[model samples]
Target chain A: MEFNAIYVIVAREFKKFIRERSRLFSAIARPLLWLFIVGAGLSRLVPSDTGVSYTQFIFPGILGMTILFSSIFSSISIIWDKEFGFMKEILVAPVSRLSIVVGKALSGTIVSTIQAAIILALFPILGFNLSIVQIIAVILICAFTSFSISAFGIVLATFYESYESFSVIMNFIVMPMFFLSGAMYPVKLLPEILQICAKINPLTYGIDAMKHVIFKFETGPMSPDIPLIIDAAVIILTSIIFVLIAGKAFERKG
Target chain B: MSIIKVENLVKRFSDITAVNDVSFEVEEGTIFGFLGPNGAGKTTTINILCTLLAPTSGKAFIAGHDCIKESAEVRKAIGIVFQDTTLDKDLTARENLIFHAYLYNVAKDKMQQRVDDVLRFVDLYSRKDDLVKKFSGGMKRRLEVARGMIHWPRVLFLDEPTLGLDPQSRTNLWEFIAELPEKNKVTIFMTTHYMEEAEVCDRIAIIDNGKIIAMGTPEELKKAVGGDVIYIKTTDNASAKNEIERLFKFNVSEKENEIYMTCGMGDTCIPEIINTIGEKVISVRLQRPTLNDVFLKLTGKTIREETSSGNDIKDFVRAYRKRH
Candidate 1:
């Protein structure tokens, strides 16, 4: 990626986020709602397992949820770009179109990471302790997840004509990824079919990986390590593939 | 020398040939209008030449770079302001220009200065920090023009630059566009469905049905059919058309509810032409056949009346909304 272009794009996205406070509010609200209300209620309903409290177990899920909501919603700008004619200006620019796509994805990723971090910060308030390394790890994981998801969002933006259609697809694809990834409940507790589905879900790997580090009830020793690496790889790989797809899609006029 | 050359360029979307074997050359440092009826392939041709859409066949070159093979170079040399407002509504006008400047790889310090200059040029300096969504349609369009100038490109592609603006806004935009050639030496290649809009160009290529039927200086095109046009308004327009066609045996087109015909030797012919039609002609006016007639003479249709219904799906959205 061209660093200058990337910086500009990210800066633009950040400014846009700041200007559209309602949009930011909605993005921040959804995950924060999930973490507070849904996670709180569900934790009491399910039998506690594996020395992980409800908040700790659910922390990783929120990271995936954060990535999912923020990344997909970021494609809203693409629709706006097409509508407002800024896209034509961007498309006709002298720079590599790939840089434009990467720039868009990076912008989305950075914002998504910040939103994810905001949600993560709520953990200590809810009575879970995160090590400095754990906090750093989750940020990277969330950022990567956001990039991959936002890249895919851009790919969808090329094919979708309206935000209604985009939101429908996000509901169809991302909502399922969240539920199936064992975001609310551990995969071991799901039905056999859902469990199978969860294992394949990139979200599952992300959630499971984060679970290895989050400390709740101060009971668990240093957690599992290898799976987080594997999950990180999946996210990085997905980011690479979807970003390339987005770049090609942006190059297309129709 | 021609700064932009398009030869036998064709583009098809499934069954429709949006752009047929259209060919034209644009001289450097002159404003060349690409005129056509709606759906007349003006936008399609512009899109192809700007490297946004690939031509089905033939070729186009911008600033010596082939559009297809050297797309990036073409992109660098040409700036496009699309017919649709392409502003980032969330950003201020200045911010939007800066984004475009950075995309074109303008230096950071220079980006600020250029952003200010363009905003000033568009007369949006007062609203520079105002979000674009708050601006009027004309304001947004001017900002789009500013965005196009961010890179300081030599050739600018404007696809229907003044469409949908109020008459006052259109006039403002026209005056701004008219000054650009003299001010910046920018080779302006613009497409417009509006016949009157093309008249402002130094030269225009009137295209219809994916073909350029006429290409020349606006005056030359009008003079080719005749030195000027004779407008005869009558309640019996059909009869008047028949009588005129019978006498002159020339092509004609109508616009704005007025029937117009072109003829050579306008000074001498106007009196005879009016007398032949009888005095029932409520008013007789003679002026140059406009770019509109040039378009009509080439294709057997009026350029103003042919609005493109490119997709049924877009219609469905509106229809579905009404039903609900």
Candidate 2:
């Protein structure tokens, strides 16, 4: 609905994204710090059960981390827009709430996917070779994961009015989701209660799916926490559901 | 013909009624001003008319479309310049208009031409490529007005379009807005606290405490006050006020340190007031009734007293932030 409205929103975001060079730099640099500094240091002590190196074991988690931060913060633009009153201009336009939600989700997905791809290109530097097919699959997985998180972020954004309150709430939600996502560690190593939380987090499926693509073997303790089909299904289903919820949330703006 | 209509609109925020049983019609191709003090439901009424808010009861229609049921059509038919600046400060003036055009679904072929025309109309054509963050307060407001009209909606709602601008810029922006009804064939429904700005409107509605206290052309409203106004500042205002009320039998109101009253033939009454009142008068002035006087007579409060309260600090901060 109102496809041009969606296009304009996407284009406007892209222009702002390009202008803010520091944001792009920081988005890329944060994940690299985790991958190189944290992953490299932990790789020595946290030896993997599988033949895969510890650096490679958490590499998928690194990608998940990149997507999680970038995609979720992309919705922060909404809070900024609200603060600056630009959201009122858009809300008064002849566009559907669905178009606005889809446009935001698409822009977030694209931006986070681009950041994830930059990190994915570092596979050679990490001494792990990925086939072109595997690389494309990983990118697709990153896009789906980013879309779901972005939609969920939009859903949360609708409930907030100020950057301070939203940031406070985001700290409460984002950090736990990251820790429980099996991003820095395997789900099997987690406490039983945390394992339940990991199962609930959509990002867990995302990182697990990334593990399926990058790792050579699927039958080990370090293997994906869930089946590939289940991971994909959860992400796709969550994305659709979050987007619908976000669209409905916007209706209450009236 | 009436292009905008509201039938007994009432909006309540929890237990407080922000807009209560208000109804009015705006004719096509005219400038209708909504004059009210702060929190007088002016913005609330505009929000409902623009389809940004739904009323708890009653109905509003814009350009023949029901504001609640046919909101999309109403949105398509209206453009608003909010009391605060809403332009994307990161984007260029041209890009902002183009974005608005797309959101309003302007024809692809005509989009560029429309954007150019509006930029030129607002006199921001020279700075079209510059980021809005670099613009002065006045320039940003002009661009917002330009963007509001780029879509050529049937009605343009301006909620205090020149609230923060300097007096010179206010006059300049007001000139552009005053021309829209005739030059662009668009109905203008604006809310402002500036009495001078409200004077230019084809019709004015003075709202207070969520009610429309008076509605008419500026002349008609001012005439209803039925006298000239006299301002007296004396050494003793309490006795001066009581003395003026006793001697002239006029309804006296004290604002700040000055005592003012509305009385017929104020020109002749001024000398009599100075001579007969035993108190030493510090100053005396007489003037014809203005829209502010009418508002004061109706509401027992001066419109300027309410609006000018916090403006100095805001002006200072804005002036300090100006970049070249």
Candidate 3:
């Protein structure tokens, strides 16, 4: 059965992730730097009319940013595998292409969620008093968000075979997704066209779901842009669709 | 029995015909080599047989499984060591083998034994725990070979297995590869531009420009060249070429200031030529026909004339674009 193949691909990627200590450090460090540096500096200029401070306002978005970068870049290993010739080893095996795609998505999900959890753990220091239920809810949202985004990244990975091309395209998509995703500001504040773009972005709903769980604001300027159920549903549905697309991409290549 | 068969195989990349109307059969339990220069379609043929490529318009079978229709089965029956190193540099040597075993669906109970046995077969057991990144080029290659064999494939496809190794390492790696078919009863299908390396094969097909120009055993190929070769460098090669042809009635060719020709008895001809030739005799040497000579005799050009730089660019471009 290809279950063993999937297990081994995941195991191999996880082993590599662990061996690269710098990756772990940087994954965790990137989110915290934004929280302290950007969040602190922007908090004074952007006054919070709502009860929450600006730093507290953007906390969930910070977690979303963590997931966005980690989940998306995790599939960069595909480019690395191609460059280093390791992809040929896996491609020539008896395993189905679906198994390989599922394995990559799962590993990226796990790795990204771990980084998100570290950022979520800093909530207390950032002055948010969260109960255990909210923390679990946030972790669940991060996992779903990471899986969908990672699968999307895999779809992008299938288009190009070089690191330079992949990075150039990633920067084009990732930064705008972050800025317009209501991560730093509310979606309502964006220009109409960009707000449309933000609404279409999967990360927007992810961060909005985090807000729904953390703040529990049902209806306010500070409330989540989309309903909690809708956010969860969007993430789950996109994850399936993206995984199928990536799987088909691999199948067509062979 | 023939383990691999290709009939009228053709693979075209838009305008370039990489493997054009190729046909061959590889016998079971014997080393069969595809001898060709870079971009002559050696790797392209191997890729088609290994199920990594679908031929443009032909049928290929591996162990009775169709390469295109039954690719998964074909893949299961064959293992490939590509031209470049494919080992996971961050993983230990044993980890790489174990990963490969798992991918091939090796039984969990037998996984440990097979991994250990293959590592030992490659003589890498002592350094099984070392990361591949720490290994030298030769060690990484040995580890790759060990990984390729962990699943006990019926046919092992080695594409330029010794392409970039030092002489000692090349010989060392060949020792392990040369022992596989005899010791393990596995049919080995490999490709090499190295004429000496082609000599190890039980049978060879000389491919050039996407077509098999000649196919036979090494001895048969050498015998086809006919007679021994005598190369003479005189102070005046123009006169030497004319003098030798005129006196001995032999067909002589001049290349790089050296006049050479094929003669039935080079031992006797060398002295006769030296005594009769008018030009001053500078140096003389006689050699039995080698595979290089066989190649030269067929194509009128040495295989070494085509450098490997073109293949490097092909690899680079292949890495930059998705395979069609």
The models' CA-based lDDT, in order, is: 0.78, 0.89, 0.87
Q: Note the DockQ of each predicted structure.
A: 0.58, 0.66, 0.71
- Sort the candidates on DockQ, descending order: 3, 2, 1
Give the TM-score, chain B only, in order for the candidates.
Answer: 0.80, 0.81, 0.85
Residue-level lDDT of model 1, residues B1-324, one tens digit each, is 999998999999999998889888999999999887788788888888888788889989989999999988888888888888877777788888887887788988787888898889989999998888799989988888887877878898888888899999999999999888778778899988888787789988878778887889988887775456666677777777778888878666654445676667778877887778876577766665556556555664556566435543244233323433
Error of 2 at A17 (Å): 1.1
Top candidate when judged by lDDT against the true structure: 2
Measured on C-alpha atoms, candidate 1 has an lDDT of 0.78
Higher-scoring candidate on lDDT, 1 or 2: 2
Question: What order do candidates take by TM-score, descending?
Answer: 3, 2, 1
Clashes of each: 8, 0, 0
Task: Give model 2's docking category.
Answer: medium
- Give fnat, all candidates: 0.90, 0.92, 0.94
Residue B65 alpha-carbon offset, candidate 2, angstroms? 0.8
TM-score of 1: 0.86
Candidate 3's C-alpha runs over 4 A off are B231-261, B264-284, B307-324
Error of 1 at B119 (Å): 1.8
Model 1 spans with C-alpha error above 4 angstroms: A49-51, A83-85, A216-226, A252-254, B229-285, B307-324
